[model samples]
Target: MKIHMTRILTLMLAVFLVIPAFASAAPTTKGSAADLRSALGNLLGEHAILAINTMQKGYDGKADFADAAGALNANTDELSQAIASVYGDEAGKSFNTIWSSHIGYFVDYVKATGAKDNVAKQKAVDNLEIYRLAQAKFFATANPNLNEQELAEGLKMHINELLKAFNSYVAKDYASVYTTEREAYAHMLMTGDALADGIVKQFPTMFTGDIMNNPASDLRQTLGQILGEHASAAVFAMQKGIDGAPDFDQAAAVLTMNTNDLSNAIASIYGADAGKAFNPLWSSHIGYFVDYVKATATKDNTAKQKAVANLEKYRLAQAKFFATANPNLSEQQLADGLKMHINELLKAFDSYVAKDYKTAYTAEREAYAHMFMTGDALSEGIVKQFPAKFETTTPTVPTSPQVSTVTMQLGSKTIHVNNNKMMMDVAPFIKNGSTFIPVRFLAEGIGAKVKYDKTTNTTWIMAGDDKLAFWIGQDTMQLNGMNKKVGATVFVKDGRTEVPLRFITELLGWNVAWGKDKATIIMTKAMAPASAAAHNMATDMTNMSAGHMSH
Candidate 1:
């Protein structure tokens, strides 16, 4: 039995540069996280298919190997372009050098496997191990969040799968070979996902908003998947249609399935009526692409013209649907974008028919990327129209108060008041042997009204039947016309009036307990006489001052 070089090469290439090719095809411009993921996923998935096909042909000594290699090269160029878009041309070139070396090693592995040379096989494996470590180290250094160990493990899994598939093919275990091939393809998708996520997180400004992975933007991701898959499947199906390939039906079915998912997504957001309206409008454009492909394949000039004409009409209808659905989206702009989408797909189909493989792949990438923009535009419109459904919100200031179970420390600036239901802006701090808290926060928390007489430099506190007034810089406070001494006078900090915590809490008939070990002052409603509470508070205050106070 003749050992097929193509079979081994197919699996090897399927697992090697396919992932980098997908990674490189990621949209360089700031897109939604969903868009980035979809781009990488689709590119990786497609490259896997091409890489596997290349190996199969190479093994069989068939002529199609050249086309397969061309497609893989096209994927690499797109990948490098994506990298150049993000990291600069020099970085992209550097990446190409390192990335190409691994592919060469995989080629060497396939060649050695064909010869059944044990020593050569071991050398290839050794080189791959070095490549894996180098690749992991490079990514780990580039992305702080991506651990070197984790990346090394992931790369090892990829290499092992390819090797397993190649070995199975050599042993004539066709089932195992195909099974491993599928696993290798799926693995590249996972790799693309990880790579896209890490890059997006590391450079959030390069993506739409800094929240691509945020659960709130799930709708965006879902839309990107549905629409992006449609673009990829539809384009590939069109190419198959032109070739009259046996898998054309299956490819076409995938396109239809993607359309159904998109319709369901729309129905979930709008009513079934809107989904019904959207389905045909969306499906019509796909039909026109098939028509264009068929016409091109048959050299039917008239049918080609008709398909183009129908697509123009489809564009207007789709644009109108979105404009009517979302007030924020302009119909004219949507039409223009849709037109570009149509042009890209047509160009790709035409190039494929013309056997201009490079242009076909490039156009395919552009068409695929355009769908992300479509998903983004549609999702943005839907989010705007039904903000509550998507659970989208304006970005909040990081320092703004968050509503949660409240907790506070004695010397910390963060105070949890109002029965731990809300956080207050004022932070409590120890000052001059006393813990000073924001008077406004304390008063509001305890249902008291605080009034400051700016001219007189006096602050007044009004509770149900209690009235207390204090003068700034004065040690004496008036409690219903009786003078009482306070440890510290009222002062302003951070635009909030600060008062001694113990004096204010005790005066309002609230009990204060000092936790010396925890450095916490727990306050609750007093159950004893105000005088008893004041005595306990005074003792605790002295202890707190002696043990924990700082000027």
Candidate 2:
């Protein structure tokens, strides 16, 4: 086809640069803030690389464009999820709409380039300009501290740099293309840093220490960089494995180096003993993933299953090691979370084997995003267990609820709670006339104790003398040692344990008021002695320790 390289490069540049702007602004702890930065950097970096690769492939009339495009869409899904982690599902959906539109515009630009249609190319550029303004406005509104004028200026610069890169590529300037690509990748890191800094400053309580000012922030960022890069490299390796690409070995080697970096970081925090234990367990999982890919290529279903079984064992061992290393880390919860990670990677690999590019890319994006959570959990645990090592400072106590009158809607998984202005990973919804909410969000909101028993798939809530226990996937519950039937079944959704709001509130002697017109459920606790409430809140905060806080 020998398509117009310049136009394709321009479209790629425009699409990749705008993506990171939307990828910013998620709720995170000190460790997670670092993790978030790393995740965004890797995601945006990969997008840039993939966009360039796709453009090159299109220029040469290669078949890899579909795979690249699928991977790009996967990146979009992940970016949306990151936003949703801080914002609500509605906001995430809204972001996807705007973000995807720009990608579509770039695709149109590419088509025009291929067809040599100058008019269509100009139209696409016009659309992109409009998109740039809309995106800048969206983020500025979301985070007031982010200067709209500054954001606009920064975006303009991104566009200019991308155009320069594209024009250079068109002129067969390989050196300039490589130089601009590096600049573009590095620029997104700055974008991620700015976005993360703004969000953390806006919600100081949600993150660990001041990301902008703390030394520990550097540690978190380093960890995030290493771990996030590992995920991106691993996914790229897996894709190369399936394609039998010549660069597969190089990509695989890079992935291994990333793992070594992660291990070195662990050793720095926990000493060589812990690192020795961590290296084998961490590296083994990567090996297993590679094995899965190989088996799939050979049509050896039995070998694939064996690889999965090995991963399950790895998850348990890894979870236990972290939990034993840091008391604040829950073994069962870690395992549960780790299981999701393992499955996501396996699914991505399997889908790739099946030649389902869309499904493969979707799984790849999910697997990549899951690593940030893993990084958050591990870093948080390490920071908590060895605070002095991180040069961490104690957080000041707040006198009031981070937010007043937090609201949740029925049949929606959007939770508006916490000081960070981030959405709960799981949303509250109505089931069979009773409202269901994430136990931790509601219980922790009112200074109640919430614990999960992974062995029995049950959750325990203690608010004063009244204790309630519910099993996942069951309608039966225990109220103060007595068996009781609930209107709605307790279940686990989106990695959270959910329970009926009415039953739990009633047991705790709290009022559950419903706003039918608004389809909202408001839980109000009766006024207690000020001293008592403060004590309870302090206790709850203490229970969270440093690592246990939501990332």
Candidate 3:
């Protein structure tokens, strides 16, 4: 097995690095009790992830606190990042250092235990208590405005909850493990809320301006409601699939209602028709997840294959829904999003099946978090296309663009034009000079700024002033702005375009160099001040004052 003590040790380091310690709550209008609670929950969740990751990694070894500690470290890092987003760089740095060390003590204990050194283990555990006290005092001093005694109590609660959860995991009481995990998660949320409450009481205005202060307006609430519904439906569907229950229809109806709530919220942010399309698409996903879970329970190979097949069907339907809901979406764009979503679910399910609870929960956390992205994507698309509705609203930001094509100049080399979209994905067939790209892919991926003229049998690449056109089966290109023509063939290969890569790059004003030995393509260009440069250089330190305390 890939699982081993060494792997567990590695994971322990990760947990210590990622998870942050709780801190005293300062007054922030944006901070809330819920915020505090979530922080605490995340702290516990981080421990669970590492513990589980450790157990999975060291399946053959004695599962212990070392695994838990590694996960805690990783969670601290995650918390530090989230804090950096709120507070400034210094705060995150401070948190990473402080929270990370506490988990180190746990590792010492684990190593001691492995060596059968009770005295050393006892010393390590005692050291943990001292470290806990120092941490509590650190928070108290760090945030002078917070009630030190109250903060200490909260911190103790968080540590105890986490310790208990870790213990259950060590005992291999899986049900208790999960229950404790959830409890720890909940406790963190509570602690976070307490901290946030303190802040809200201290500084009402700054935090109040953000929707985070309003429980009714909170996006997390919407996500929780929708996800809860979806999860319930999924669970029921799986049970029905397993028992071959006739009452499955009833459960599905309830699930639909839950999905309806999700879609309705989406529609409110998007539109009615978009919401309607999302309902079935969303429901089908739940059905597929349920089918997969059922197959796993029965250890049914054929059933699992059928479930995977069903997943494909669900993907197409989901893709179609996205296309319909987001009219501006191209087929490639839809396919990319669908593939990511499908992969995430599969990864989470695989982790769950393997009893690798750490990865499973991590995947769950990611999946839950991603739903917000889904909401944001749909919202942004609606607002961008139909500016009349969904204007002037704050939604979660989308992921940064991974693919970009820019123009550059190198003296006489005066490089211009690059279809970077095509260049990036030629891994399958670079042996042949011509690269094949599906026709529908152009509309979805490469950027939606492209147009396909049906009557003219030409495809237009909308970049800047230069609009390059290519027709089928001919090695000729036409500039839409200018009547200038260049030699390049757009031949049909397996229902895709086999166009000239150099021709596309030159059109985009970029120098493209290909390395045959390394199978690498490099594009160089000057940085544009109009985009990423103009943005504030300050590390996101919006809520820097709050991090790392017990609850």
> Top model by TM-score, which number?
1
How high is each candidate's TM-score? Answer: 0.52, 0.50, 0.42
The list of candidate 1 runs beyond 4 A from truth reads 1-94, 102-130, 153-222, 388-551
Q: What is candidate 3's lDDT per residue for 187-261, written digit by digit as tens?
A: 444444444444434444433322232322233433432443243234324443444544455545656655665
lDDT, residue 144, model 1: 74
What is the full ranking by TM-score, best candidate first?
1, 2, 3
**How would you encode candidate 1's per-residue C-alpha lDDT over 61-108 as one tens digit per residue?**
544446656766666655555555555678668667766666667667
| Residue 86 Cα positional deviation in candidate 3, in Å, after optimal superposition | 5.5
Q: lDDT of all predictions, in order shown? A: 0.60, 0.60, 0.45
TM-score, cand. 1: 0.52
Clash number for candidate 1: 6
Clashes (N, CA, C under 3 Å) per candidate = 6, 2, 74
Candidate 3 lDDT at 48 equals: 39
